[model samples]
Target: MQIPRWPIATEREKELIDEVLASPHWGGFHEIVARFEAQFAAAHGCRFGISAANGTLTLELALLAAGIGPGDEVIVPAISFISTATAVSRVGAIPVFVDIEPYTFNMNPSRVQEAVSAKTRAVMPVHFGGPLVDMDRIADVAARRGLIVIEDAAHAHGSQWQGRPAGSFGLLSSFSFQNGKVMTAGEGGIVLTNDEALAAKMRSIANQGRRPDATHFHHFTLGTNFRITALQAAVLVAQLERLPAQIETRTANACKLLRLLEGVDGIRWQQVHPKINRNSWYLMLGRVEGGAGRDEFCRRLREAGVPCSPYYPHTLYQNPLYRSSPCRVTPCPNAEATIADAFWIPHNVLLGAGGLMEEVAEAVRRAILRG
Candidate 1:
């Protein structure tokens, strides 16, 4: 059987969706959405959760809620999804691209410090695939500089570092429930924060700038429609129930896959920071050394029925959107090289029990031979 690339919903998700559809409150106004927001926030050890239409918009909401806007500069990792930087730009702030650690594929804190300036307002650290950035280091740097820290935790669902969960580290953190993410709600996102003021702002911004006590027609600020429907929330509630087990399975399978590939030469595994206690394992990133081209390696893996592709084809700054937009663009040698050498295995493929991980290992060994 072909390994599935996206999440496969079970009967629970179907039943939840159906239940929501049968309810009198069918839209985002339903109580299920509130329950989902509360449950998701509590799970991540956050005081508040505000649902959004998608992760990208959630980032924008986070930025706006934090009072980051025009003429402000936000330090961002060069290696994350384009949404990370785009959100800053959408808030009318400049995104200063910081190079990543060559091995960890996460932001280099030193580079983040170097990128700071009088206009700098915040630092958005992304928890890349397997391990998170050193949050303590980043937090120290940001605290000293008086810069706000926002976490683009779209790839991290149940990940934790040093006993602290990923979403709890930053002033504001955003999660994606896109179909490809560890947890799926088809298309939804949520922002988390412990600060009650920021949480209230985020809620208002997501709901067309309407205040809780304001008149029905009275608008509070320039907000957009980013509310997530109750149906989506219901499905996510069911999906959340399975997340712990899914993460456990993925972590175990990843360990087995690592052991299997340990003897294989020329395949460099991504380094996991020691502080990471539980890795969500959004994907498994590896580099092909010994002068093997990443393209050829990915082709071989595909040929072996093991789907693999570059974590990102290019650094976020290299995208044409940034080139056209008036944002700070800088060269990140490490990120540039990383995009060229990276190849990843989808996390969902590890869901199957039995010899699936062994099959993955065998495929990697075969690919190396072809490389």
Candidate 2:
């Protein structure tokens, strides 16, 4: 059972790249980059999109655009990639870490209320592994608390909740085109928003703080270069075209695998929310009974030719960098439990044929049996 290679490039990608290489403007000011930005934003149901250097910088740009600076705080999940919290810190604000849901491994909205402080300016919910955070609950909390919602939608390109797209739910949502993400451009990111003023601000900030129409070398605000080049955009445009089909395939394979694992003991799959109409299926997540058994289980699965690994072994607060950082931390039993038990199968494996999913399920069953 051979798995498909990731970041799959076809003739369309080559054609776009050739166009960019032949064009005079291969920089951020090219039409190719602008086109990709528009296409991605439209697909996610957003009014404006601003391209950036990478996902991390896009989060920082969103924070800065929202006026989140010193003396402010942002609520984030304890179980996300470090960038979710670090982006808040990069903008001179503190990140208040909250717990996540044990089953979904997403920010626990019930914990958001307790994490809110007088200094809290926004709530940045990450859609971990392509399953959306409970946006409806997160929105209600933010509204009552008067906090902005900035979605770290790095793992949620096509994910939707209650028929609404992931990038459209927040004041500003960020997406990554990193190599590991469902969509890839080698390295790139984009910010999506409906607010025209906020869009302009992020656009300017990403392009060295100059007005979009400015012809001269005049800096309007304190900003640095965090621009995406035409080359990356060219690849991303082709990738975006291929995304819908890929998402369908991944979802089908995920459903098949889940069905096959139904009677398997000691394994619990990530529970999808009732409201989630679509999941991007970036990774198929699950957990075993014991933390001690998790590693050996993964080792066994890999030996059986199923690509698997433990998901974030530690919560963000457990990192050494957080110890000296100016951030607030609350008890996160769910996050801790998730770190101990959860493992993941990469999205690329799901891109394989339906028969491959059967092999994956058999591998899981064997791993559990041996343990």
Candidate 3:
């Protein structure tokens, strides 16, 4: 059977689209967009939310709102998707690479502590795939050094740590509603923060820098048109409503698969933190062990009709963009190691019923045995 892939849009999404089309205001000016902004923000325990066209822009807008500019350095985990680094670059700031914890696939808090230079203005901690970073440790370090925390919660919607929502910890946090994310609107993002001033600044920067109450053609600061449409918001609101159930199914599937693969010697799963009350399970990550080839194992799994692939092939600092840019490039052996061996099962496949997860587990077992 063909395993389901990302963006499992349903009748609810279509109905929302129809509702949007029937309305007079279809762009960012509609009531749906306003309601989505408020509801999504409140759901995450943040007082305000600013919708954006994409997650990367959300990060850039947040940085800009936090006054991150040229010469300001933001510490970023080396193991994240390239957007984490690119967002810093887009804001004319430097991204200082910090090594990740190989098992958790998140930035090592000690390395973050060491990477903070005099020019450091912020620390962007990415909750890679389904797991959260050691926010407590990172927060302590940031507090000691007076650094702004901008969480990259692209993969962490509906995820909580120590009973607090993922996006609520940072001065600013960003979430993606891209096609493959935990919640999707085809393409959209939001920045959440309790700081009213920061939220207002981000909103202004996203909307061409007009004052929140301004009606005239007056530009208050440097900004761009990064606004998300009412249609995307409508779909996202529906997705948000469905997220809890989706997360539950994915978690159950992940656990079952983990149990089935317990005796496998050549594969290991990502370590979930004890404090992670919920995991959105955007990608079920595993590492190839014992010198086994990651590609070969993934090939076997795919041959068995279970889709799988290696995670990011390269650490962010290893990319040519960082090579050419004028930024501090640090050694991240942990990130390098993690990227070289990591493979992921897309969360969408786990959404299926009818013993699909058992099939995935059997596929991995057969692949490991063959290896």
Among all candidates shown, the one with the greatest lDDT: 2
> Model 1, stretches more than 4 Å misplaced?
1-5
Better of 2 and 3 by lDDT: 2
Residue 68's C-alpha lDDT in candidate 1?
94
Residue 348 in model 1: lDDT: 82
Q: Write the per-residue lDDT of candidate 3 for residues 1-371, one digit (tens) a residue.
A: 55776787789988988999999989997889989999999888999999999998888888888989898999999888888999999889999998988788888999999998999999999998867798999999999999999999998998889888889999999998888898988899999999988888887788888896777489998877998998999899899989989999988888887887787788878999999989999888888885358888888888998888888878888888887986786788878887778899888888878878787777888887742
TM-score of each prediction:
0.96, 0.98, 0.97
Candidate 1 lDDT, 1-371, residue by residue in tens: 35755677789988988988898877788899999999989989899999998999889988998999998999999988889998998889999999998888899999998889999999999999857899989999999999999999999998999888889999999999988899878899999999999998888878888998997688888777898898899889998899889889999988999998888987788899998999999989887774347788888888888878867877888898887887775569888888778878888877867888888888888878851
Give the C-alpha lDDT of model 1: 0.87
Return whichever of 1 and 2 wins on lDDT. Answer: 2
List model 2 lDDT by residue over 88-127, tens digit each. 9988999999999888989999899888889999999999
Model 3 CA lDDT for position 123: 97
TM for candidate 2 is 0.98
